[model samples]
Target: MKRIMRALRRCLAVTAVLAAAFSLPATDAFASPTAPASPTPVVGGKRAAQGEFPFMVRLSMGCGGALYTQQIVLTAAHCVDGSGANTSITATGGVVDLQSSSAIKVKSTKVLQAPGYNGKGKDWALIKLAKPINQPTLKIATTTAYNSGTFTIAGWGATREGGGQQRYLNKATVPFVNDADCKKAYGDDLVPGDEICAGYLDQGGVDTCQGDSGGPMFRMDDAGAWIQVGIVSWGNGCAEPGYPGVYSEVSTFAAAIAQAASNL
Candidate 1:
C-alpha cells in the first residue's frame, strides 16, 4: 500500500483555531430563558460520559489534551510521539493530568506512538492501559484497506467555527475516499503507516474538526459493536467538496496497538 502520501499540512490545519471562525452567513436569533453561554473552550479536551479508551486532546491553542485511559489514549504522533523522550505522552487522568492520579486511575505504564509517525501523515498513537481490556469486545482489524463503507466519528471538540465546550460530544459521518481524490486534496502529503483516507464526496455531511484528534472513527456492525476502523488525525477546511476527511486507518496499526495492549 502507498502508506505515505502528503503529510497533514503538518497538523497546522488540524490544530488551527478555525472552529471559532465557523459561522452561518445569516441566521435568526434563537430564544432561551438565559443567553446561551458561549461554548466553553475545551481546556483539558472533551469526551462522552466515560469509557475505557475514550479520550482526546488538542495540540494547539491551549495546545494540550487530557488522556482518559491509561491503557489507550490515542493521540497524534506529532503532539506525542517518539518526539518526546517518553516513548509516548504522559497523561495524568481526569481532563488534565491523564498520566497519574489516585482518584482517577487509568494505567498501562506504556505509551506507544508509531516510530515513524511524524506530523507528515498517518499520525497515530496508542496507550497500553494499566489493565487488560476485559470488556466484552472491541475487535481490532488488521486489514490495510477499509472494506467498510460508512462510519461515525465523535469528539468533544469545537464545532465548525468555535470551541471551548467542556463536555457534550460532537460527531460527524465519513464516507470512504478513493486515492485519486485523496491525492488531489493532499498530494504527496499523506504519510505511510500514519494516515488513511476517508470522507464523504456525495452526502456532503461528515467531517472532523478541532479537538477530534485521537478519537475513534468506528464502523458499526449489525450486532451494534462499534469496531474502530480509523482514528481522526486531520483534514482540510471544515468541510470541502471532492476532498473528504482523512484518518489513520486503525487496522494498519492494529499490530502496534495490540502489542502495546499485550504488555498490560
Candidate 2:
C-alpha cells in the first residue's frame, strides 16, 4: 500500500508545494501512497478478519476506499490525479488480505475529483468501476452529529510512522478531536468546516498513516448501520502526539458527493 499509483508521487509533489505556500510545516504528510516497501499492519491496530469490512476496497494506487455504490468508490481526491477515464486503476475487494484468492478486482473506468482540490482540504473523490462488485456499500454521514465519538479506521497502510504498507487489512479506534483543539494543533492547516480531526490527542498512540489516505473513518449509526463520517487526508506523522489525523468531513460534501455519484 505504498506509492503504487502511477501519479501518486506527482500528486504528493503538488501537495508539498501547496503546504509550503501556506507556510505549513513540511513535516505534514498525506496519509497517502509512498514508495513501495515491506508490509506492516496499521499502527496500534489489529488485523481485520475476512469479510469484516466488505465495503472496503484497496485501490491500485495503494490508497484505501469504500464502495459508495455498486460501481462507484469514494476515496481521497489526492489518491487520484483528476476527473477522466483511467482503465489502469483497479479496485480490489471482498478480502482482508490483498493476495486472497477470494478477493475481487475491478477496473476503474474513470475518476471524478472534487473541484478546486489544491492538495489540502476537499480531499474526497470518486472512482467509477467498469462493473459492479457484489458487496455491501458504505453509507456516508450527511450530518455532523455522526462526527463525534470513537470512530473506526482500517487500512493496509503502514502500522508505524514511516513504516511500510501492509498486505493484510488492519484497524484501530480513535476519538474525535474538537475543532478548537484540532485547530490549535495544526493552525490554519486545519480547515475547520471542510475537514475533521480524530486521534488520541495527548496520547496519540492510535491513528491513520500513509497509504491509508482516502479510506473511511466510520462508526455504527443508531440503526446499527455503518456510516462513514471522514475520509483520511493528512497529519504530521502517524500517531504523533499533538498531531491528530485530519480527514475530509463527509457532511461538508455529502450533497456534492451524491450529486457527483449520480453523474458518474
Candidate 3:
C-alpha cells in the first residue's frame, strides 16, 4: 500500500535515489506468487477468507486501506482531498474481488490526517465515516511489541507491481530485520522515528508493495490475538534487500488514535 500523496515521488527524486542503492532477488528468482514451500506468504498463497471483518471497509477512491470501526475508517491521508464528487470510494469486504463491485457506497467521508506525521510519506488518515458501521473491532497493539524476523501484513492490494486486483485479502511474511540492521542496510532511506523497515535480506521476495499502504502489519502474541503494531506506509519495491517495507509506528500514534476513537 505505498502512497505518493504527501510525498509524491514525482517531487522527491532524491528519496528513491538513496534507497535504490540496493536490491534483492526479483519474484521469479525467489518464489512464484503461489510457491507453497516458500515461508511467510508466497504470492498467490491462500488468501485469508475475506469475511472476517465483513464490515471492514477498504477505502478506494484515490487511496486504498481497510476500515475497522464503522465510525472510524482507518486509511492513509493520500486517499482524500476533501473535494470533488468523482472521488468515489467503495467499501467491500464479504469477499475479495476487485473485478467489479457494488461495494457499500460511502455517502460522505472525512479525513482526519494524523498530526505530526511524515510530511513526505503516506502516514496520515483515520477517517470518520458518515455513520457508524457495524463491524467487529480489530485489536490495536497496546505495547511496543515485535519479534525479529518472520512477521506478516495482510491486505487487498496489488500482489505484484502494476498488477490487477488481488480482490481477496492477501498476506506476505518476510523476516523482520531490527532497527540497527535496517539503518545499516538502508541509511537515509529509513528515517528512524518516522519509519521502521522489515523483510528478509537474503530472499528479496515476499513483502508488501504499492497497494498495501495504510494496511495493518500484524504481530500475533502469546494469546493468539493479532495486535497491529504498524501500518503499511511505503517500501522500495516489495522486498528489496537492506531496504524492506516501511511502517508507521503504531505505538507512536496509538494515544492519538485512542483520543480520536473517543470522539467516535
Give the best candidate by lDDT: 2
Global lDDT of each model? 0.48, 0.80, 0.53
lDDT of 3 by residue, 113-209 (tens): 6665545443646766565656555566555665344566776554455333334456666556677877776566566765566677666666665
| lDDT string, candidate 2, 66-183, tens digits | 9999799999998888898889788999888676689899999989999998766788999999999899999999899898999999997766754445667888889999999999
* For model 1, the run of ten residues with the poorest summed lDDT: 24-33
lDDT of 1 by residue, 1-264 (tens): 232222332132343333432221211111121424333222122234434334433332212232323345555554443532243223333332222132244333455567765456546665544453332334545775444587766654544423332234444556677666677777776554555677766544456655556656767655765577776666665455666667777777777766654553
What TM-score, computed on C-alpha atoms, does each candidate reach? 0.62, 0.85, 0.72
Quick one: ranking by lDDT, best first?
A: 2, 3, 1
Clashes of each: 39, 5, 9
Kindly provide the TM-score of model 3 when superposed on the true structure, using C-alpha atoms.
0.72
